[model samples]
Target: MAEKGGIHVDSARELFPRVAEVPFDAEYKFMATFHNMTDEQGKPVVRCCVKGAPDVLIARAGYYWLPGRDPAAVTDENRKLALAENDRMAAAGERVMVVARRDFDPTTFDPKGNLLDLVQDLTLLAMVGIVDPPRAEAKDAIARCHSAGIQVRMITGDHAVTAAAIGHELGIEGQALTGAQFAAIPDEQLKPQLDQIGVVARVTPEDKIRLVTMLQQKDNIVAMTGDGVNDAPALKKADIGVAMGITGTEVSKGAAVMILTDDNFATIVKAVEYGRNIYNNLFNFVRFQMGQLVAYITCYLLAAFFFVLGGVPFAALVILFLNFLISVPVAMALGFDKPTSGLMDKKPRPLKQPLLSTSQWVRIAFLGILMAIATVYLEAIYEEAGVTTAATMGFVAFALLSISRGLSARSETETAFDRDIIHDRNQMFLYSMALLITILATELGFLQRLLGLTSLSGDQWRICIAAAIALLLVDEVIKVFLRSRLHDVKAPVT
Candidate 1:
């Protein structure tokens, strides 16, 4: 029996009859070794042998072993044939390994200086090909990445044929380049071809760094994944470094920005989806908060200067209630919104794209102005009754209007009543609760006295609700107009 790193001998045990069990000797522990010999019919026969890469082992072997023939001296033609066989297996996506052995006497053997010399002039024994297929979900994950306008490339240490074969199965497009070929390309020429390289085979750590740098030169946000110490430098250089928690070296994990606990590529795709959703939710939060601030500020300024009110539209306590109890809750709910349908179908946003686009600002401005007009008009109509009554009307209307804007902010282009807004349990529940709280704040006698507010009749409440509904209707019209004209410009929302 033989045992060593990089090869599993137990799987091949069935090839030979089990005469007896033998412990692996530490003396012949090299990848290429001559472990034990047996006497069969008065001739010494080598039992267990060498194991290493086919190309490396074949070069050291001086003779070839075949069935029904004496060991024959290796010729140039024979070496070519053996190497061709290795390539054939690699092209078929199999991991090929070569076995060989050398005759030696254990009593006098001395492994000094370079122990590798012990494998010279060896007899070539056999070649093994093992199939290693990709994970079942890998192809679909890759396809999803492509749909999202993210290009996926495979950088590997396998032979070009092997890498290419695997890349094909994984849905990676473009030609595969060996590391040597990729390195040979001049910097000026390589920059343009980075996108076209689907696979870089037989890559060294340096090659990975160069590829990442070249991609960066083109303004790409590169995400590198690795599990070895040699990959640390490249992983650190990447915009987003991903390490495999299960098999990654400590150095690699330390250098990476993110770790994949399951060591699956599909998880990377899922992360991207989640990241996009968070960004969208943040955008909505900002949009809704900004629109409400614009409405409140614009209403107060217009009412104080133009209308009979001398100062601020609402009292300090009312402002506090509207901001914390109403607006803050809705904004927080918007922050946790789920990813919208067809989110992954859209292209990745450009790095230079602003958080809010021109069209989005225009939409926000329109909504703010419209809400402000409704608030000021209501205040002016009820000013004759009393200042407290007018402020109460404005307060109730503004609060309801802000909550309505939160729902419409769930989407940039879709209607406020889109399924994403109406069916979202979190947003809908919070919106309903906020609405109920607004009504209670007005009707509750203690709240009215504390906040210097007045209760509203059913008709006044209906008017406030109608104002909120009108704001949504106007927002829907703006969304439709933007959607129709957005094709002419850069639509960053998608």
Candidate 2:
């Protein structure tokens, strides 16, 4: 301690070594390491001696001191001044703390290991100031979170001024209150006004649970990030708890739903981005599959009654091939499509909304009606032909309709030739593959005999092409209408 350039000015202790006593267990509360130092200025021999030092060391360890004196005396003036100075330092973006050492008149009062003897008379020691700067990436990360509509609040145990100063430096502005202020609110008033809180200081573990609960009461999808044993309860109560893997305690990690390995805020933004893309891909698959499902069921059921009321148009084996080989592959391709351009630009979807929305079902119904009408018209044209040829024509027509919807399912904002449409090349390839398999099943003799398919003539192929192109027009028109001002302005991800 002497080599560190710290001057040990033990004016009263060094001159009276016998006046010190051992630092008991309870004295550590005021950050008091030892209270056994002798005050030889007042006493002769030290009954029990310990070390006496200024409050400078204690303050550096993050503690503030409280000095007491008579009601109308000037002795405690310096301690009050020290506390005020520390508060000013705290408001200037520095952590300020204080320390003290006290001694009792062992003669006038019987001294023991009790509070009356320990806190009899106090001596102000020192105040400390510490500055811990923020990281360069922190401000940028916070800004990104704001853009993404994620609220970032700082919960700390520092003094309110200290927390506010640091928050200001980190781009977190607004009113900040201490935990005492928050807890003072009546239970009835607490919930109604909880959302306005921005920064909380001098917060306890119990305060954390209260904050999490209040935010949840406002219907927030809370994502609490914590890395301490005290943070376990809040982490568990959050909707999506994020724990710091590197700095997080075992208890906190166990309570969290996600753990950040690097403990970086920017990573969370990246996660939201990818999460939105994944959701879009999933719904894209659903929309594509559902749209075609409606069309196929409508067309096939109508054919069941009109063409093959007593018998099946396509065998069970052929239906299996159609579903597995054609529909499944297209659904998979849409499920893995790239992120759309305006995915992040839109607000988050409501948690309670159904997977396939009402609007989506309406679109599916429109496509279904069109496909059924087109199939019935084509089947009527091929009525004079044999049952096998008429059935094959209807199958080819429905296959064309499914392919049209699959490709059109790429985006609501882009057309077939839009430059961004190139991202769906894999999807287009699957469509081509599905078409090739359908043609082969119809043309091959052994497969045709096995699957009950008849090849379409040249004129029949032209009619199927016309029906497909017409249905594509219908799909595009409805998409353009939905993307207009009549409904949601955010373009749907197909």
Candidate 3:
């Protein structure tokens, strides 16, 4: 056994025989060991080892045994054998160590030597490059964003040429800038360049942050997408940060508001549609509620004024009941309605736009006032015929208004007659509920008495149904005119 440091070797063949030649052994035992080394500051550093079978031992020490003469011309055959044996040992989960002496001439290996010269000896391992192909749906999604008044930009660490190529493929417009170009611009100057610089390449993490800040300075709501650790900071700074979960680092995902599990650009497009739909529904419901509130307040105030003047009209109280109980339920049914055709095709409403825009307020005001006027006029005629028709006329008017309001609330882009809106199962369900409520209110004695209302006579019922049909027809007519105007405006001009 020969001992060196922590290694102990036992072999039948003598490694350093004093004679002219030494006999080779069929079997050998070899080992190499090491312990941690400490620096001058007493910090422990990693240790290493080198030892194995004679041929194995020589190779492990990074030495090539020559057939004759020089000790360096071992050829490729021996090198192949050494690598194969190492792989076999590795497959068995055995750790194998390779040791090699530094072969550089000390005089030539200067500290300031060009690193590229040393790197030239490194052959191509498998090409370690990424091919981030645009998703098939990315182009369509980009077009959709453009139509929706949203700008899409590509910010990447890839080379300018590669980034521009991808941006072109994804349909992004404007100039492409490398990191150097972006860095050369002052922060104040970057603000005006955001719209014109659509593809930013080789940008650092700080560059992304600055870009987002510059966009924010212009009051643009930026939605950024990224999948790297460096992207985390920018993701957190954007209005909406979308992370590609499939390819994103944990840091990026943690900072994002939304994660795309499939990393498909189409997902963002779908999400935008859904978000807009939710906001639209919310706005519609609120507007409808506001109209109902205004009507209720007006009725109560009028009823109080009339009572104070000693008139005390029962019809006013009836109107109040109708506004709260019947009109409100019908308007709520509009919330459950299906999305209008071309909903996604329309641009997103400006975030700064008031909740009650002029057009929306005008529609609500006109419809509510028209409904009230028509109800009162029709009831007045029924009463003028003089068959003790106070309760009956009120009931008929209330019923007509309730049903017509639903049709009036149809999308500006579509009519109540539109197949998609009319055929939605949810809308159908709401209509069924409305019908049930109306029927039950008419039949139930307590409800009828509380509201000073009554079921209609056969002839009176026919008139009420006719009035409802007329109201619906008027609602449809308004929608058709508005929809036609909208279509004309949206149509491509020759």
Model 1 weakest 10-residue run by lDDT: 20-29
State every prediction's TM-score relative to the real structure. Answer: 0.87, 0.73, 0.67
Selected candidate, larger lDDT, 1 vs 3: 1
lDDT of 1 by residue, 203-305 (tens): 7788999999988888889999999887899999999999999999999999999999999999999999999999999999999988988888888888778
* Candidate 3 backbone collisions, by pair: 60-99, 61-99
Error of 3 at 60 (Å): 31
What is candidate 3's lDDT per residue for 117-206, written digit by digit as tens?
A: 232111111111234456788899999998888888888755466567678777898999977799899877777777898888667888
Local distance difference test, candidate 3? 0.61
Q: Which runs in model 1 stand beyond 4 Å of their true positions?
A: 1-50, 104-112, 116-122, 420-423, 485-494
Q: How good is model 1 by TM-score? A: 0.87
Give the number of the best model, judged by TM-score.
Answer: 1
Model 3 CA deviation exceeding 4 Å by range: 1-130, 187-189, 297-332, 381-388, 462-494
Candidate 3, residue 295: the lDDT equals 44
Model 2 regions more than 4 Å off: 1-140, 165-174, 308-313, 410-417, 424-429, 443-446, 454-463, 486-494
Of the two candidates 1 and 3, the one with more favorable TM-score, higher being better, is 1
